[model samples]
Target: MRITGYRALNTVQEWGRAVGDANGVYADGLTEVPMVLVTTDEGITGVGMGPHVELDAVFAAIDGEDPRGVTALYDRMLRQMFKAGHAGTVFGTIGAFDTALWDIKAKAAGEPLWRLLGGRDRVVPAYASGLDIDLDDEDLIRTYQQYAEHGLRTAKLKGGLDVERDRHRLSLVRDVLTEAGGGARPGLMLDANECWSRKQAVRHVAELERTLDLIWVEEPVRRWDAEGLAAVGRGVRAAVASGENLSGLEQFRPLLAAGALDIVQTASVWGITHFLRVAALAHGHDLPVSPIGTNPVGLLHAAASVPNHLASELQVLQPPVGVALDLRIEDGAFVLGDSPGLGVVLDEELIGACELQPATSSFDGPGVRPERAGHRLLAAAG
Candidate 1:
């Protein structure tokens, strides 16, 4: 079916607790979830979740193209924005349209996305990520306990500001998971969100390694610092995981060539095609790839087809407002149902009814890096 037009909407994810990393936290614990609904000439529609920036420009490339030709159209969309560059939010816009096209393609095939993508298994392994750097000790325990009840034995905590606090918090999460798993060795991970310098990353992770056995340390240094990432990987026992902030495969070449990352990562918001491409690239390097997102159901389908998928980050147990997924987290894995195309259904009524709240502060939010993040070492020295 040929593509017709698209509609954009916004919904909010009520995290129930403050969510943030080394960058900053939304004290109110609310974050916006952007969505797009692409319609076709045959009355078939597909929904995609991501940012809305450059939507009109990007969608123009596929306005009348066949949605089933998703891969070819994905490339065409990139070329459509060649002069303007397809990085940052523009890439996210492309990703949103790409996912929508994939959704339409799968639905048209009358098969679930996993089967359409040639995934043999319906279950994908998962790890809990609470974005809990700002959470107190009691809240932290409560948060992980909820995930453990769902049989999640692995968890990643947000930290990197203070070594002592990170150590304490990591221990707490480990104990929670261990208890839930009947004394099984629980897997623990840390995400510094690129707040530390190379030396600080090495030192901080080294200290934590003395006690906690981290499965991986994520974004210890900046997203693009290949040398710094390699240094951190060399000094720490846990594998270094990054690349969620990176936009495209070209951005990952440097890190891969430098042997910097042990575990490669991509955000779900980047869309399904990008994850498949990144997974293939990481597989060539003999490295495991993981996906990071609040609800990475789409990427999880793509992950099922990749042989090198390590584990996917399960940020929240529930989806955002107005969104529903045909998947269940069971026995430490995501059990995807046989719903055709992404298995995501959006309630237009609920979404339209939800009020959109503006940012509380420019300095405090998910992507806003803290002012003193990389300068913590100098501050300590002084």
Candidate 2:
């Protein structure tokens, strides 16, 4: 089916400072969210979440391309992106549109998106992420304890602003996990969110390791500095995991080939096709793959289909309204519905109740916050 039309929605929600740990200050008292729904000639449609920045440009490029021609279209997008100087925003569009394309293809085929992607397992492990350093000790303990009670065996915390504070709170995470686990500790990971210099990352990781063994340290130094990332990996006792912020395969290739990353963290922002491609790259290296955000539904499918794949990250706090997620958590893992395509839809009722006016200007999110994001941690503070 030829791609036909697209619709975009920008949503804003207020979870209050108590519940927000987004990277930038939502001084407008709202969080910005966006989604794109792509429709095909056959009337099949799929929804992908990301900013609607370049939907028109992407549509113009892919209008007549067969949605089923996945490989060719992907290559086309890559070439266009490279020509555009690999502009960061356009990559999000590429990822988002790729998702809608897969959704249309799978719906047309009458199979669930996961099965279309060749995934046998419908259930995928998940880790709680989106914690902010702004949260206090009690919030830290409570968050881990909540995860433990959910039967989740692992959770990653946000850190990297202050070495001593990170250690203190992480120690509390250990205590809560151990106590919640009946004296056994649940697995732990941390995202410094690329807040430190390479030297600071090395020293901080070493200090944290002295008191608590981490499953891995994520983006402790720089998100794009492969060499610096490699150095931090070499210095730390914990495994170094990154790539959630990277766009296309080019960014992943250098660090991955150099053994800078111990785990591959892909978000749905790269779409499922690219996700699988990157997974293959990591798999060749015998490293594990994981998802780093509340990714689109297609990503969970890719993770379950592969052997080295591990848990997906879900924010402890999603917008209290607007979005509808068909995925559920059972025993702390994500359970996908056997519905065709992604099985996610916009909740008009909730959206009406919760939606704020979309920001008129650009702002950063927890994912790209020049600062580490909030509310999940802010909620804990309350």
Candidate 3:
């Protein structure tokens, strides 16, 4: 069926507790979730979740094209932004449309997205990520206890501010997961969110490694610093995982060629096509690929088809307000239902009824880099 038009809206995810990393924290734990609905001539509408920048310009490229030809249309959307450059928020816009088109293609085929993507298994392994830098010790225990109840033997904590505090928090989470696993050795990970310098990353992770057997350390240095990342990887026993902030495959080429990243990662908001391509690239390098996002169900379908999917980050247990998915997290994995397409159903009325918070400044927010992030090294030296 030919594409007709699209509609965009916003919803919020109430995280129940303050969520942040080394960058910052939202005290209210509320964040915006933008959505796009692409409608076709045949009355089928596909849903995609991401930012809403340059939607009109990006959507114009595939206005009358067949939604089933998703791959070609993805390239078309990228070319539409060739002169303007398709990085940052614009890339997310393209990804939103690309995922919606894939949703439509799978729905038209009358099959679940996993089956349409040739995934053999419906279950995708998962690891809990709480974004819990602002959470207190009691809240931290309570947070991981919930994930432990879900049978998640692996968890990633948000840290890199203070080594001693991070070590204490990591121990708490590990104990909880290990108990949940009946004394099985639990896998633990840390996300510094690119707050540390190369030396700081190596030093901080080396300190934590003395006690915690970490599975990986994510974004220890900046997203584009291939040499710094390689240095951190060389110094630390745990693997280095990054690339969620990177926009395209070309950006990953240097990191791959330099043998920098041990575990490659891509954000779910980057779309299925991008994740699939990144996965293929990582596979060629003999490295494992993981996905990072709040709701990564769409990528999980694609992840199921990839041979090198290590694990997906499970940020929140529930879907965003007024949205539902045809999937469930069971026994430390996400099990996809037989719902066609992305299995996302939205209640626009409910979303509209919900109160909207004031927009956060670009310079602030959990994922944004803090002003004095790496400067702490100077204080420590003094």
Candidate 4:
């Protein structure tokens, strides 16, 4: 079926506020999550949600294209991206189209998304994340304890601000795992949100290794610093994890070629088409890949299907506020069923009730405020 039309859902939702990571604070009890809904000629629709941006060009790229010809459509779009003129909106559009196309494709095949991707019925391992770094000691411990209680084997905490505080919190994360007792204490991860300097990352990692065991150190230096990131990896025993902010192979190539990352995390760069390419690239380098997103609608199936996937990163908070489906977690994983498409059954009422937003996530990052704007990142502007 050809894509008939597309609409963006840029609305203020409580889901954004209560849940967020180390990059920024999202709650004054308010925040906006941008989502896009695409409909096919047959009336089938799919939803893609992430950082919102202008996507007129993206819509133009997909209009009338065969929904099942997603990868072919992706090549055309990628080739035209330069003329289309920029990053945030481009990735946003691709993400939306990818989800919608995959949804339609799986539905047409009458199979669950995971199955369509060659997965037999099984749980996608999940890592507890999507936590607000602003939490205090008591609440932080309590929150992590909750994740362990939910059967999560791995959990991540936002870092790169205060080394002492980060160290203390990580120790507490280990404690929380210990307290939940049954088997081994849970695996722990840390994402710095591209906030630390390479030297700082090395120093902190050295200290942290002395105490808690981390599965990896995410975005430890500026995301664009391929060499610096590799240096940090060389200096530390802990593996370096990145790629949430990366665009695609052009970016992943240098990072991997330089021996920069030990683990690769991807989201909606060039949709699943490009993500698969990157995953294949990472696999060639013997790197494990995982998906990172505040909401994982477009990521779950693909993340679960990757052979070297450690676990799919699910925001520790999004479920409570709710998503398109009743995503259930069991034995530290997100389970998918026989439902066709992405298996996301939208809460139409929730989608309808959301207040229209003026603006949402920008290129720099999500949760960036008006006051925080007016700056470029790393070496240049995207």
lDDT score, candidate 2, position 345: 69
Q: Which lDDT tens digits does candidate 3 get at residues 1-382?
A: 8999999989998888888887878888788888889999998999998889999999999999999999899999999998778988899999999999989999999999999999999999999999998888899999999998887999999988888889999999998888888899999999999889999999999989998899999999889999999999999999999999999999999999999999999998999999999999999999999999998878998998999999999999999999999999899999999999989999888999999573564347875766787767541211
In model 3, the worst 10-residue window by lDDT is 373-382
Query: Better model by TM-score, 1 or 2?
Result: 1
lDDT of all predictions:
0.89, 0.72, 0.90, 0.70
lDDT of 2 by residue, 60-88 (tens): 77777778776677667766666675446
**Cα lDDT for residue 268, candidate 4:** 50
* Number of the predicted model whose lDDT against the real structure is largest: 3
Q: Which stretches of candidate 4 lie over 4 Å from their true place?
A: 11-23, 84-86, 268-270, 317-323, 355-382
Evaluation by lDDT, superior candidate among 1 and 2: 1
Better of 1 and 4 by lDDT: 1
Residue-level lDDT for 125 in candidate 1: 95
- Give model 2's TM-score versus the native structure: 0.88
Tell me which residue pairs clash in candidate 4.
129-316
